[model samples]
Target: MADPVPALVATGVAHTFGETRALDGVSLTVGARERVALLGRNGSGKTTLLRVASTQLRPDAGRVEVAGADVVGQPDVVRRHLGVVFQSPALDPALTAREALRLQAALVRIDRAEVAGRVADALADAGLADRAGDRVGTFSGGMVRRLDLARGLLHRPTLALLDEPTTGLDVLARDAFWAALDRRRADGAQVVATHAMDEAARCDRVVIVDAGRVVADGTPDALTSALGPDALWLDTDDADALAATLRGEGHDARAVVDRVLVVSPSARDLVAPFYARPDVRALSIQPPTLADVFAAVVGGRGGR
Candidate 1:
C-alpha cells in the first residue's frame, strides 16, 4: 500500500505577539480518521495552534494544511473541509437550537431542502433532538456546548477542531460529549485541544505542549511507559524516614504527601522487603498514569 495522507498537518508553525512568542516551531500531524488530543497549560499556545489550524489566524512562519489544502493559501478550501468549535459558546441566545442549525447551514451554503434533514441528523447525533425547538438561552451550558458541536458538524467536514470542548460540563455531560466525539471519530478525524488529562487519555494520540512547544507526543500508553516503572504509593508513619532509607539504598523515593511516598521503578522490586518491615503500614503499586507521565515530561504537576 502507498503512504497515507494526513487529514491535518502543521510544519514549523510559529506565531508571535509583540515581544512574546505564542507558538515556537510547533509541528504535528493527524492521519485520516485519527483522533489526536492537544494538551497544554493556559497560555501554552494550544488555542493559538488551534486558530492557525482552523484558518482563523495566519502563522508568522511554517505551514498548516487541512485535508491536503494549505490553510493560508487555500483557506476557503480548508474551510470547506474543516469544522471548528470555539472555546467560547457562539450561539445566539434568541435562536432555538433548530433555528441555529438552520442559520449555520445557510452560512455554509447548504441547500434549503437539505438543511432541515441535516439539522435533524446533527441534533439527533448530539442527543439534542427533543430540545431542538427550545431557545439556546434556556439550554444548560452542556446543552449549548452540544448544540455548538451539532452546528460544527452540519457541513460534515472531514476535520473537526475542538477547543476545550468539554469545558463547563459536568461528569455526565462530559461523558456524553466524549461519546458523541467517539461517533464522529468513527467516520473522520478529530483534533481536540484540552487541559483535562482524562480527556487527553481518550485520544488515539496525545501531544503535550508547554511554553509554546511540543514537549512530548505519543500514544497514552507509550508516553506513560516512557516515564519508566510503576509508582508505588506507600503510607507509613514516617514517610521522610522511609524515603531517606530508600534513597540511601540507591532507590528513587520521594515524599508526595505527609505520609505518602512515591517510589521509583527500582524501588518497586524491593517493595516486598519494605512490606516485610514491621513499621510499614500500607503500600499500593500502580502502573504509571497519563498524569504521572505528563508531570514527568512537563516537570510539574499535570494541569488542573
Candidate 2:
C-alpha cells in the first residue's frame, strides 16, 4: 500500500522574537489518524509551533502544511482544513454556547442550513449539550474550555491542534477533556500540547522538546524504558543513613527528599534485603512514569 499522506507537516521551521530564537530547525509530521503529544517545558516553542501549524502565525523560515496545503502560501486553505483550541478562552462572554458555535460555523462559511445540526453535534461531542443555551460567561472554566473545543470543531477540520487544552482544569474536568479527545481520535488526528505527564501518556506518541529543540520522541513505554528500570521510593526517618547503607552494599541509591530515597531500577531485585531490615520503613516500587522519562530527557526534574 502507498504511504499515507501526513495530516500535518513541518520542515526546518524557525521563528524568532527580537533576540530570542523561539523555534530552531524544528520539524515534525503527524500521519492520518495519528495522535501525537507535543511535550515541552515552558517557553520551549511548543505553542509557537502550534500557531504556525494552525496558520494563525507565519514562521520566519520553513514550510508548514496542514492537510497538504501550505500554511504560509495557502493560509485560507490550511485554516479550512484545521481546527485550533488555544490555551486562552476564546468564547465571548455574551454569547450562549450554541451561539458561539453558530458564529464559528458562519465564520468558517459552513452551509447555513447545516450550521444548526453541526453546532448541535459539536456541543454534544464536547459533552456540553445540556449547556447549549447558557451564556458562556456563566460557565465554569472547564465549561468554557469545552465551549472552545465545541467551536473549534464547528467546521469538522481534518487536523486538530490543542494548546494546553487541560490547563487549570481539576482532575475530573481534565479527564473529561481527555475523554472527548479520545472520541475525536477514533475518527481523526489530534496534536496536543501539554505539560501533564499523565495526559502525555495518553497519546499514541510523545515528542519531548527543550530549549527549542526535539530531545526525545517515542511511545511512552519506550521513553520510560530508556531510564533504566523501575524506581523504588523509601520513606524513612534516616533516609541518609539508609542510602549510605544501600550504597555500601553496592545499590545505586540517591536521596530525592530529606525523608525519601529513590533507588535505581536494578534495586528492585535487591529490595527484599532492605525490607527485611528493621530500620527501613515504607518502601515501595513504582514502574517508570512519564515524569521519570521526561526528567531523563530534559536532564532535570520535569517542569509542569
Candidate 3:
C-alpha cells in the first residue's frame, strides 16, 4: 500500500523579514498522530516555520500543507484541521472561562447548537469546570495556559501546533500543562517548537534547526546515541578555545553554550587531561543528552 498522508508537510519553505531570513528552504513532515519537536535555540526559525504552517504568515518561497490542504491556497480548510497554542497568553482578564471558550467556538465557526456543549466539555477538560463562571483575571498562569490550549483544540483539529507553550511556566505549572496536553492530544499529530532540551527529549521525534536550516532529525535516543555512550563536559572560561584545542587533537569535541563537550564510549578516560587545564573550572561525565546531540549537529554545520 502507498504511504499514508502526513499530517503536516513543508517543502523548501522560506520566509524573510526585511534583512532577516527567519526560515530558509526548510522542509519537514509530521506523521499521523506523531509528536514532533522543533528543537532550536532562540532566533533559530522554529517559530517562523510554525507560523507558516499555521497560515498566519505566508512563506516567501515554497509551500506548507496541513492535513492535505495548502496553507496559502486553502487556508480556511487547513485551519479547520489545525490548532495553535501560541507562547503568548491571548486571553482577556475580564472574560469568564466559559465566555472565553464560547468566543473561541464562535471564531472557529462551530455549529451554534454545539457551542454550549463544546464549551462545557472544554472547561472540564482543562480542569476549569468549577471556575467556568469565574473571571479569567482570577486564574493562575497554569490555568490560563490550559484554557488557551482548550480553546485551540475546541474544534478537534487533526494537527496541533504549540509554540513554546511552557515558555514562562514554573516547574509545577509546566508539569500540569504537559499532563493536560498528554490527555487531550492522544489522537492527533503535534508539532511543537521549543528551546527546552528536556521538552524535545519527550517528543517522539526531534528536528534540530540552526540558522534557519535543519541540522538533524531523529528519535531522541537515536540522536543522542550517535554521540557514543557517555559525554564529558568541561566547564571552562573559554569553551570555544577549549573545544578548538580538543578538536585539533582529533577528539569529537564541541563547544555547547558555556561548556566544552567531548563524547566517546569511555568519556572517563578522556577527562583527566582536560580537567588538568587551568581554564577548566570543573568537569563531569554523564550519558549523552539532546543538548549534546544538538551541539554536535550545529558544530558539524560550521556553527557554535
> Which candidate has the highest lDDT of all?
3
lDDT of 2: 0.81
Estimate, for each residue in 245-274, the C-alpha lDDT of model 3 and write its tens digit: 888888877887778878778788878877
Per-model TM-score versus the true fold = 0.84, 0.82, 0.91
Error of 3 at 175 (Å): 1.1
Q: For residue 264, what is the lDDT in candidate 1? A: 60
Q: What is the C-alpha lDDT profile of model 1 across 226-264, one tens digit per residue?
A: 646786667788877887876787766665544444546
Order of candidate numbers by TM-score, starting with the best: 3, 1, 2
Predicted model with the maximum TM-score: 3
Candidate 1 error regions (>4 Å): 1-4, 232-265, 270-285, 301-304
For candidate 1, the TM-score is 0.84
Where in model 3 is the C-alpha error above 4 Å?
1-3, 276-281, 299-304
> Which pairs of residues collide in candidate 1?
none
- Alpha-carbon deviation at 29 in model 3, angstroms: 0.3
